[model samples]
Target chain A: MSRLDDALREALRREEPPEGFAGRVMARIEARKERAGAWDGLMAAWRGPRLRWAGALAGAVLLIGTAAYQETQRAEGEQAKRQVMLALRITGAKLDLARARIQRVGYGLGDR
Target chain B: MRIAIVVLAATLGTAWAQDIKMPPAFDKLAAKAEESVDVTLDSGMLQLGGKFLSDKDADEAKAKKLIGGLKGIYVRSFEFAKEGEYSAADVDALRSQLQPPVWSRVVGVTSKKGGEITEVYFKTSNGAQIGGLVVIDAEPKELTVVSISGAISPEDLADLGGQFGIPKVELPKSKGKEAK
Candidate 1:
């Protein structure tokens, strides 16, 4: 009976905590709550439409920039095509001159 | 059906234009040239340019037809401030790129009076279709190279003559059979 009582007392006795253990625990709890609050705030801000709107604006700007670049490239290509036609015309005229001259002399130009 | 045909033709045209190889050295001469013109048009640009051609003008209509199957047109012309700015070696370098079986020199016209030399070449494939054309004209102070890729006929080109500053090329009359 005494042994059972002793065991009960031992089990029920309050033990002394290590020094500053409660301070560490309290600090940890406070720090965790602060971190959680900050995270919560960030999540709320992200969930708002401002970030999404910003994202959409950025995408639109990028698309406009790409379209502008393509337009410039196409313009340059068109200019190049015109220049090509002109050059070919000049080339054809020159070849015609040579051929006409050769024909007038009756010395036929060589063929393939 | 017509749309499909046009799409197919455009696809084939683009495919044909990719075979040309130009010497990198030509850029150096272009810089030194007093007057220079450089043009490179791929299939896409050709089709786009075709839209602007006048339907009423016979010359434009003929050019549109001539360029129907053409994949690409590349031309480079350089007029120098003085003679001898270009070298024979540069010309030789360009000439070496053209070889037999795939390419054949069709015509050589030399005029001593103006100190001009012109050589025309046709690209042959399968003995049925001419795939490309080249013209190299060298003068005392000017040099020009024209390369057209894809299936273009001599007559189609001749159709574009007498207009657009293309002095009408009187092709030698066909006798017996045909020269081309």
Candidate 2:
């Protein structure tokens, strides 16, 4: 029992720490604080209004680009439709003129 | 060498199938014309234009239906300030391409008083169905050549003429009537 008590006393004795031990512990705590601060800063930036504004701006740009593309396509389609109508008009007029002339010439069926 | 020749022959044979090879003189005429219109719509453009056409509108709906089966529509028209901006040789060059066995002259009319000549040709496939149509209208002051390729029937032609304020001509339904 005495031997166990001596061992316990030696193990639990309050002795002065080694040189710079407190300084090293304090330095390690400061480093941990700095790491936490950097992570918080990054999170704060993500949660800030600047990021929201940037996202909104990107969305607006995408929407405007899509609208502009559709408008250009519509304009091209309108032009193509007009040209098609004109071509068909000219073709029909020519055919009609030829038919009239053929009827006048007494070539009834226009087989030639 | 044999494969190369076969490939080239196949390419040329496909080109000569239905489409008309416009003469180079058309470019010269276009440059000299007071007003010119050149519309070249391949199948892609036609399909795109057809998409934009409104089905509710009668004219657009009719046009959409007409262009549905068409592969291409090429029209070149020029109006000159003077009467002799183009020569007969230019017209003849285009006419020479419309040879027989594939193309047949269906209608030809010459008006001396009006100084106009109009010829219509049909491209027949499999000796039965009309695969294409070409119309050449040459006037004293204007010239227009229209070539439409792909499947088109005589009824479709009549419908096209009937629409767009053009008077409709009665075409005989029977192939026997068209036999020359």
Candidate 3:
């Protein structure tokens, strides 16, 4: 669309890497692989029994914490159940009293 | 003196015993409830709804038996990270369900504070009471719907609070456990 754009496009043309680029890339990749392998071997050797024991201890603590949480939930549920039963019992008793009062009133009216 | 105290406690405990024996099935149903809702079906009319919290340890057979006694159970819940996620269209959809031959809308109350609309409906069959429905629109907080069926006294409905476990009345204390 413009002469400036055409000149810029001509100035910048696509080109391949140098002839030894492929070989240089392969050499770098091999070096990285060797370094990674050695690092992994070193890490495995450094991981002693103490580290394993620490991991296991942490896991056990987590398990115990989970169990305690579950027990607390269970206890709360039981307490709620007890409260509900008590309330229901009270309501039933009140209804009974109301019924009795009504019956007494009816009997008194009959006597009159 | 201890014997007298024990006798008095026994007497009080016997008097405090519940008269109405709610069916065992109802007990199981109450146990399953997680959250209980209370709303006035109409201005001065009351209704209650309970949401049961499902549990893996729950007895399936017993829960089923308890649910079977219930005439109607309806639930409508919305989850939003922020407020104002719902529109009037959502409420209208629910209102439409309460329309027609089944229910007659009695009153509609709207609140300016929360933009909440409470619509009450009464259901009848041959001019006799059957059921009632209540739709509440509360924004930025919560929304609730309560559907009540069977012959529930209006007075009893008004007494219901958030606690769904059971009703409490003054009762005599028990003494037999103390002796043991």
Candidate 4:
């Protein structure tokens, strides 16, 4: 292997990210939770009902909107696909015409 | 009656708006191949664009017959099955190809929804634009490229719609075994 290939292989061989990576990540998450504290937890509980209701309503709206949008997109995509196909057909026809012209040119040259 | 008229008007408007348009033709000769690549070449740094392949392929003769009139080939593609399947380093490899005196950066547009990055480049010949390139790093579900070459007109590109052998509009009653 070339130097670049060797280097790439070496890099690939060292698959492990780093030592204590998971521990460090967990510790950071725990620290954040501690800083958030009991008051934060209490507030979350108090707002839980309202938040659930709001989330449900938002989800319903989002689902409906997404369905409508997806339908429109599907229709548009179909239309565009059709257009592209048509374009290719037309282009193909033009190529046939050009080939005929070239053949005519060849024939003319032969006659000379 | 008023509602019906309003609906009809809206439908007509939409149809008009969606009408396929073509660009103006110049003295330049752009061949019509079975597969077309619309490339915008500025300089040595090439930015590959778009490709249209013919649906039918029987043999080399047929393929050549279909592609004989084509002028250029353009391809914008990406390979990714899952999230984070590709990394910055992979993109950097592509970017590295466009580095320095050959190509200069113009714009980089990243879309979080599709997890794609489109970087546009200008080919420099003594700091002049002789070509253009766009690299799109996209997920399997979302990838697209638009390439043009040889004095291409935007209008022609738009009109290119419906010229290829795309399926035709069929009514529900006519839908038979072919529908599947």
Which candidate has the top score in TM-score? 2
Greater lDDT among 1 and 2 belongs to: 2
Per residue, candidate 2 scores C-alpha lDDT tens digits across B54-94 of 88988788888888988999999999999989999999999
Predicted candidate 3 versus true structure: per-residue lDDT over A13-107, tens digit per residue? 87789899999999999999999999988877667766798899899999999999877766654443333323323333333332223233232
TM-score quality measure for candidate 2? 0.77
Cα lDDT of model 4 by residue, B1-180, tens digit: 999999978865553333111122200112212223332222111211112223353322232232333233344333334444334554464465555444555445455664545444434433222333323323333332332222223233223322344332221232121211
Interface RMSD of each: 5.0, 4.4, 15.0, 18.3
Q: Candidate 2 clash total?
A: 0
* Model 4 spans > 4 angstroms off: A1-112, B1-76, B79-81, B112-114, B126-129, B140-180
lDDT of 1 by residue, A1-112 (tens): 6999999998999987999999999999999999999999998888788789889999999999999998887786556546646755865675675566556545444333
Q: Clashing residue pairs in candidate 3, if any?
A: none
Residue range A22-107, candidate 4, lDDT tens digits? 99999999998887887698788868987898899899999999999987766654443333333344343333322223233232
**Clashing residue pairs found in predicted model 2:** none
How does each model score on TM-score?
Answer: 0.62, 0.77, 0.32, 0.26
Ranking by lDDT: 2, 1, 3, 4
User: Comparing only chain A of model 4 with the true chain A, what is the TM-score?
Assistant: 0.40
Residue by residue across B1-180, what tens digits does model 3's lDDT show?
999989977764543331111123322323333433321121111111111223343332222222322344333334445555555655665565564455566535455675655454555445333344343434454444444443333334233321233333222233211110
Clashing pairs in 1: none
Q: Against the unseen true structure, what C-alpha lDDT does each candidate score?
A: 0.74, 0.83, 0.43, 0.40
What ranges in model 2 sit over 4 Å off? Answer: A1-43, A109-112, B1-18, B167-180
Where model 1 places Cα greater than 4 Å from the true spot, the runs are A1-81, A108-112, B1-18, B112-114, B169-180
